[model samples]
Target: MVVGLREVAERAGVSVRTASNVANDFPHVAPETRRRVQAAIEELKYRPNTAARQLRRGRTEVISLVVPEISSPYFSELAAITVRVAAERGWTVHIDQTDGDADQERRMILGPAGRSVDGVLCSPWAVSPAELVELAAGPVVLLGERETDGVLDHVAIDNVRASREATLHLLARGDRVIGAIGAQPHLQNGTAELRVEGYRQALESAGLPFRTDLVMPVRSLHRPDGAAAVTRLLEVEPRVDAVFCFSDELALGALRTLLEQGRRVPQDVAVVGFDDIEDGRYSTPTLTTIAPDKTQIVRVALDRLAARIAGQTGSGAEAPLDLVVPHRLLIRESTTSVRTRKG
Candidate 1:
């Protein structure tokens, strides 16, 4: 005894075709008719069969969101938002983690499992520009990464701008000789290169000499990597008073190392980090960092994906939305003023 579309149409006193048109948002349907159909649908609680609808429409009504890693708060929060937004739009969301490995990334994009989803929203690492171009064969939205050759729609914060702002925040606090713990150097894609460029820009703007030794590049942007990077930075620049970690995970590790070394945060060394996560807020002395509007990122990304799934390629939803979410520096107790005695 389940209510179906026909029952809804009968309850609304409209033909099945009219009810279908209303549900589909066809412009030809009158507003009163549309409202009536909606009211009937509400009254009947007639949930549309998603599988049937997809099969009829030849769409999966599913979007794949692939990330490099999810343990990081940034990716975890992003995934939550993406799932929420997709659910709101009545689309299913699937997650894939590639561990930032090149082969894994390519397989996710080109392999059979990838075809199960209607469209893809990817934050790829180790994916070359050429591979990205090929992956554009399917409807794809790039997030948290740079677009290669403008082949696909992308939504991202301006990494260079965010990085430059973070650096300037430290400089404004009267800290020179800023050290950076970031991902690998000469990376072809992703946020690392953009952040490095921004770091250089900040130094150049302040007439501070950029030292190659201070840019301690690491293989991963994980917490352990951050700890290792901090050790290297201090070794390279013994008098470094401030550091800008490209990620919060790395910054957390850096803080741990500093604490173990008997250095007081902000009192001995000030550290700034990107992607202001919860750990940053509760960490000892707290962490100063940059935060992006994750809510906006997920909403826009899901909307773009939904539009693509519905086969409304050009005008309905896919409108070439290359957006950059705004970011701000969140100054906390971590970076106050350096008061370390040169040993």
Candidate 2:
């Protein structure tokens, strides 16, 4: 015979309401009553119907995480971490990719997918703040630097500061003609813009002229894009001593191109990258990079989403929460040596 809540409650000598409260982990039940209910539940091997419980509470216990590209190591790794974290909290995670298209991103933000999920966690690449505010009808926690007018929960690293520090590290190593290999001038909320601004800041502070030609603009931060950008950099500024790519994917591509041209890494041209993906570590010449705290990002984003799902929020008048995680510059063999002569 099947064990039910009523039988368990009767066995524990408690009212059905009290037994239900104990089963749901409600905080107000007396200690002895909780113990009795738990004992009865264990003895009977009672199992609550999760779907029924969720239906009663009007919650799906599901969340959606949307990113620009799932194929990218950074986004893929983030998805893995999010899945693990969501499982621990008894919630299911759904992954979505937008391919960095404005229309697709907007649809994912405001369409049926957004409606079905209990909440959303998104690293929006092309969605505008106005579009989001007008269309978004669910709880959302932004993953990157999307300008949301301080009206939504956001989690990100200090992109400007981290990029500036990465540039300064290259400068400190005596790389005078440092070329930046990722610039997306089209996107308003582009991370590349912030990174380039930091690169400029570091150049100006170091009394080095910021060469517009050295700022290689790419359509995307993919490996092919990186390879093409580096090819252009080599053609225009053959004497460039160091290159800082906006992402490891780009850096990996740049590395391959440099090798094909018989250029020695750190000897002919030092290389640095952002987003320390695992590929960076195992590459022929390990890449130096800005390593964002992925674990902390996952933790904070999930925690904020969980709070939102549970209907927890600050006073209506309070500003939306923006959490900035920390980052570190990992110096590796790619930028190990200081070149006396320019490439």
The candidate scoring highest on lDDT is 2
lDDT of each: 0.81, 0.87
Candidate 1 global TM-score: 0.80
The C-alpha TM-scores of every prediction are: 0.80, 0.83
| Candidate 1 residue-wise lDDT at 187 | 56
Candidate 2 Cα lDDT to native: 0.87
- The reply for model 2, stretches above 4 Å from the true place, is 1-53, 112-115, 312-318, 337-343
* Model 1, position 100: C-alpha lDDT score: 83
Candidate 1 lDDT at 59 equals 73
lDDT of 2 by residue, 220-323 (tens): 88889999999999999999899999999999999999989989898889999999999999997899999999988999999988787667445543356889
Worst 10 residues of 2 by lDDT: 311-320
Model 1 per-residue lDDT tens digits across residues 1-343: 7877899999999998888888788899888888999999998998877667767876776778888887778899999888888888777788888888877777776652354678888887788655775855467877877645556667888899999999998899888889999857645566888888899999999999888889989888888999999998888887888989999989999999988887778877889998988899988778999898888888777767666656645555444557777778899988874434557
